[model samples]
Target chain A: MKSQDQVLLSVRNLVKNFELRANSGLRKTKRIVQAVSDVSFDVHVGQTLGLVGESGSGKTTVGRSVLQLIQPTSGEVIFEGQDLTKMSFEQLREVRRQMQIVFQDPFASLDPKMTVGSSIAEPLVVQGVQGNHHDKVAELLDLVGLASDHAKRFPHEFSGGQRQRVGIARALALDPKLIVLDEPVSALDVSIQAGVVNLFSDLQKRLGMSYIFIAHDLSVVRHIADQVAVMYLGKIVEIGDKDAVYRRPSHPYTKALLSAVPLPDPKVERSRSRIMLEGDVPSPVNPPTGCRFRTRCWKATDLCAAEEPQLEIRSSGQQSACHHPE
Target chain B: MSESVLQIRDLRVTFNTQLGELRAVRGVDVDVAPGEILGVVGESGSGKSVSFLAAMGLLPKSATISGSVKLDGVELIGASRKAVRSVRGKSLAMVFQDPLSALNPVHRVGDQIVEMIQSHQDMNTHDAEKKAVELLEIVGIPQPDERARQYPHEFSGGMRQRVVIAMAIANNPKVLIADEPTTALDVTVQAQILEVIQRIQQTFGTAVVLITHDLGVIARVADSVNVMYAGRNVESGSVQSIFDHPSHPYTRGLLSSLPHEGIERLQPIAGFPPNMLAPPPGCGFAPRCQLAIEACSAELPSLVPFGDLLSSCIRADDLRSGIRS
Candidate 1:
């Protein structure tokens, strides 16, 4: 078990709300989309906490809130014992060098006009680091398993995987203590995705940095994540060790999510019974009252609709927020 | 294989681009028996989608296509436009990945299905409307009659895909070519979509050719798999043979690279897929193959049978005998 002192980032009661204009009859009514609500987790040093969820689950919003990229409406993001939400612009800028993000689309993230070398060195220049930018760029390129010569090439010249490596190299240019990788390998092919995932682990081991690896792919998360957190409707439905979560999912939603992921082995895929959750995810603008997942949950009762379940230690050895824990 | 509902032999497709001839699909062969799901798995530019598109005559005029594509013993390639059109939606229906784009934005979902039925068959509007609702119900849409009147935007991503599946099966086509039908949806929705496809295949006895890159999806639904790399078939066999005993290095590399339960470090295949404009001589995957020898680059390896698999690797026998797994 990890000690409390080893926690690199601790988030509590994270909430993000977005305003939307809706037309009801002739009048345009303002609607608030509660994208993220009361989300909390810890990312320990030299470890990874995989934040997983389907679309509209607000997994991306939670990652952004942790870094103050998209400022949360209300939350306590304590990084190194400092609440990021309370930091001023100047103070946040100083802290920004130690935290970085790698986006999902490598192609869109990198500037097409700029050379890969300059793109990597932008962080160093922005931070006002006293060093040779060219050498630093080359070093970063080498660090990301790319040839140093690749520094001169534009983003268009690189393949999808190489562009992603360049993205990682840019993220590494600042030598950040924590990196929030938002679906970094989702765009690459399976063969290319493995290399990048391995590269991430390799970099983590060598640099001793922590990661908030946010992705929808459970199988990919299972391989890299030390701790796993399953998010649904902007809430952590389940949180525990990767082995415990994967082996015996406690929450009904988590069980259904895991069951939905098809195994590569045909025999296993054929034999394993799937917990097919009926109906689509409810609109986040007006999420189902009480338990957000109660609409599709087969075990839901009057109690589930009357009161929201809180994350509690379950019999399956994970913290799952469910009225009826399986 | 001769009793296959859809048989593709020596299928080849080339596009005349600005750079040069982009040979999207090299010589390839596939067979889909009635009620069987044939998964054509490959990465981007691997021609998994293109091979079937050529068969369906869906490709643009710039591409030069050849070889035989027999759907129910009728030749598709070089067939007359009217002949191909007549059989396209009637006997060979196709479902695409993006459903929103496939469906008209202004038209009601039911009207769209009705249009498809009217275009293919001589059904009356009233009967077609009733059939549309029935198809929606069959695809597991809630309140099919009411839902059919709704627009495409009204449905969720999963529901849109189900609507697309309903439209594809409206004519009750003998063969359905679904190109990444579930790729655009979420995992849970993908599960539902796969279930719908499976149910359609079972209920209608439709021979389905599913094109996708996700190995997991392929494993779950496919009876047989055809692995494509750099526009050619690298491996083809039953799902068990392909997953359990991958003979080709590309297939083996692909299987090993996937992040699964027991794998600590992924063994990613080195180098990217070959440039299709001017592919490497000999085996297309030779440059990336870890076990590639001098002879592997000498000539293109043909799909030769190795036990239950038809693998394109020259060292398939060695791979089968565990010389280097």
Candidate 2:
């Protein structure tokens, strides 16, 4: 709902291609996997923009690219009016202090040998912050609803939820303006996931930071996001206000994706109709021609195959990339 | 319950670990009637999977399993190795969460199914191969003959799951225990896999014991649900009653915490699951439960009959009467 001037981060025409070696007989050919393509979005200050898609949708790639954790193949990742793609390693390193990311598995993200306190303080030491590191670590631990004493324990000492809290506290160590949360709560139990999600909301409100919350669970995304972008095979198919997208999903894939999520209510789950997509997601190496979702999309036609659909504003006020959006 | 295909009574499973005797499953009872889908729903370490694994005799030597696990009126615990093996694939089959791990990567998909079929039944390889193809077809694998020759890695995650299901049902087992079968899959693919399982259940009248952490999955497919807490069945009932009137606080907390249509914010359960090695003397959920009283921590509340269900909460009446917000 914020104006364009309030944008914390703006991504334009972003693309990431990974080169993979394919062996045939004796010779090896370089096959390009189009992980992310022409993805554009904006994250407003203090708001959460959810990126949702199944595996291989390149949602994770988009998140990593925004932080310049993995440099984008091509496009503009403008943060506070500065293009990150054009920045050198040293320049990007300076900018990295403002942006951070939280991975799905907290256990894997944290070093097993290191105490959680050290893990939280590592970012501060790396960025060369002028402060009592111990106090800052304690403050951060408290901020994430964990006791300061927990910092003394190793990563394995904490529960899954506690470890995730540690992951969040570490991300917050640098006082980042934007955090790219790549499936932060996916690995936790459903009950524990809620607590983490609530903590994210509370932290955003308190710290006034923006978040690009990447997740495959649509319901979780709906619960947390202000803006929602639905991706398919590297390209964003639909993107808009979370309410607009959830209430009236314009893209066929979005509609199907929404329908497929089984509601917890037994009566509703039983009575509701589901859109069962026929086959697996097409490989990123040789993505379907024109529309990436055309193979699974029911409304696909000759036009969909022959010409790629540009993302246009639909009747629901959401932008959808499809020849015939539902 | 007399005609139940699978009956589990007072089932307890403990693992000998460095810390202590880690009690994974403790005094749980479950029954799955013929053609019924019994959903064993819980979080990680709730012992939903461990209990069923103990029943399947799949646990390692470190596990000490006791109590009764009756499949088709036959006791599996303390049974002879040959007897357990004879009934495992033929009468009681299990489909694991990861299809890639369940299947042998080196063997052809069809050959694996053939091997499974030929293991218990005295059938020729040629006939078993034909039967394997038929099973693949039944699981909705298109171009079955051509696909059968492909390796496990060649198949997609969804397709690999279908092949796993095909192999599990190859012998037309009376009971099928699918443990988190769709957890690793995408939502769309998960729907397809659930449909396949439903089809197989309907076509063969096979009793299903579906273990999952997702309540939504249970609601979508389960006839009856057994809600597991720290290694115990906290609540068990028809899906309608379990969803509509959750008697246990843990079950209620699990439901309310889910991201649904109208909820403003999630009401998360306050604390972590108890440490199994040194779990509290009373109710396992007492520490986190909002409605817990002095009595709740003092004594373990037994599963007593409520309206259309059994609840372990002593304050089940208070819960049903809307005492708490």
Candidate 3:
């Protein structure tokens, strides 16, 4: 991980395991789903870290754990040089003022009963910072490119993109240092996704905000992210700078995932042949012993299933966890 | 190209809702040729799904539909209930997005496929069961016999979709309309499902209509594409023409908005999709279009044919080189 003087968020050896019971007619069996395992990353001021993965990759779990939305099974999340795992409820709430999150589905994230103004104002009131609430709400609305009059309307009255802007406004209301965006624009249309992505960039520039953007769209991640981490089956398979990783990807999983993405251009697509991976993602509860991706890896050898590879820095500054790096 | 196996002409659908009449699909048309994949690209309210639902004669009573839907020169839109039912799963089949909901939960996976085969071919249980296992094997499902005995809840998302696809192809239909079949699955699973779809088209020579919002998915499988905006087809062309030189302002906006590897910044189209209840009298995309002129707001732009594409933009000639970042 890249060390920086101005570390906004640092995660070390993070892990999250969920417990579930499956009924088999007469009996129930307990199982543990290792959602996230030993995931670590660093976020600095005015930087964006894009976490890219498919379902069951634990990308969303990492985002949620960093935000303390879900308690990790074992890990250390340090925010502004203070460890969040050791903080008390009161202290954690105090620290939460500097952290906020924007969820994926704008339709469900916003409360239908509350006006947009009240939703944005809830954070301000919670922090007990005395101010003209109406003025603050209006300012926040304008900041996210929404009209000040939009504050009076409910979530259903607005479009998906507008609702997302309201969500951004609420996150910005707290003057947070870091924002965890979990598929923020995935719900929006292609044209609308661009607008929301641009707003994020502008906000990062104007407010000097650090972001942890989690999305499955590799192309969209290229535009917003400075650092990129590719996760597969509860572990980080590759992490490096955005340009380096996209240009000269070292990990086999990263290469396959990128090739699977279809470019909108027909000429480019016709010229390219996809490197398709075989089989579905193995269950997290019973993941493959050594390399999680060995089952689908074309270059897998006998040694791959015998020894788990550690994340090591390669020549291109990419920290890849693959015995057979491309 | 070969003759169109499924042709839709001047399709219009309006829903009688409480919030006024919502014109979901407005005179939309599409074509599917034998063994060719046609992609209908659009946003949530773009009527890509509605148009196909109308073509299949599957809309609810609240929706008023009028159009000419022909399957191999046979009419389907105004056909009798029995006629439509006989043709639906036999000559034409559809693959929905959520296979879990579409498939019966209590029935065995093989039994369901057997039912699909038996209903169309009038076969006995033993033969239909044999055909069901064969369909499963063709869809790349390993251990077809053992997996067929499992319930819907027992299979993974990808496997369930494979089963659904097996049922869709049971009768070897000429046309298969798949509406966002891969949207609910993971990317890896999406690739596997798409592979199955492509293989199905290759083996059965079935025409596929792949309706999805993902430009990536469309690019992967679609031979030709129809770009829909606000309940209308703004552009129709070969995949090459649509990507190489998009003539419609809406099509250009869509391509530009899509983030790619070389993209440094996104030039997102401003504003939102139109409200279908009271669609704009002029060009539906005029309010959000950067290339909108006075004429764009005064009247609807008729489809104008270019090299190999048809674009519904008044400024198509002026903006010929296409918009690319």
Candidate 2, residues A1-326, lDDT tens digits: the string is 54433999999999999999989999999999999999999999889999999999999999999988888899999999999999899999899999999999988999999999999999999988887999999999999999999889999889999999999999999999999999999999999999999999899889999999999999999999999999999999999999999999999999999998888989999999899899899999999898988899888899999999999998889999988987
lDDT for A137 in candidate 1 is 89
Question: Chain A of candidate 3: what's the TM-score?
Answer: 0.97
Best by DockQ: 1
- TM-score per prediction, in order, is 0.98, 0.98, 0.97
In model 1, which regions exceed 4 Å deviation?
A: A1-5, B323-325
Per-residue CA lDDT of model 1 for A86-179, tens digit only, reads: 9999999999999999999998999999999999999999999996989988888889999999988899988999999999999998899899
Q: Candidate 1 or 3, higher lDDT?
A: 1
User: What's model 3's TM-score?
Assistant: 0.97
Task: For model 2 chain A, give the 10-residue run with minimal summed lDDT.
Answer: A1-10
Instruction: Write down the C-alpha DockQ for each prediction.
Output: 0.88, 0.86, 0.76
Model 3 regions more than 4 Å off: A1-5, A23-28, B321-325
Q: Report per-candidate TM-score of chain A alone.
A: 0.97, 0.98, 0.97
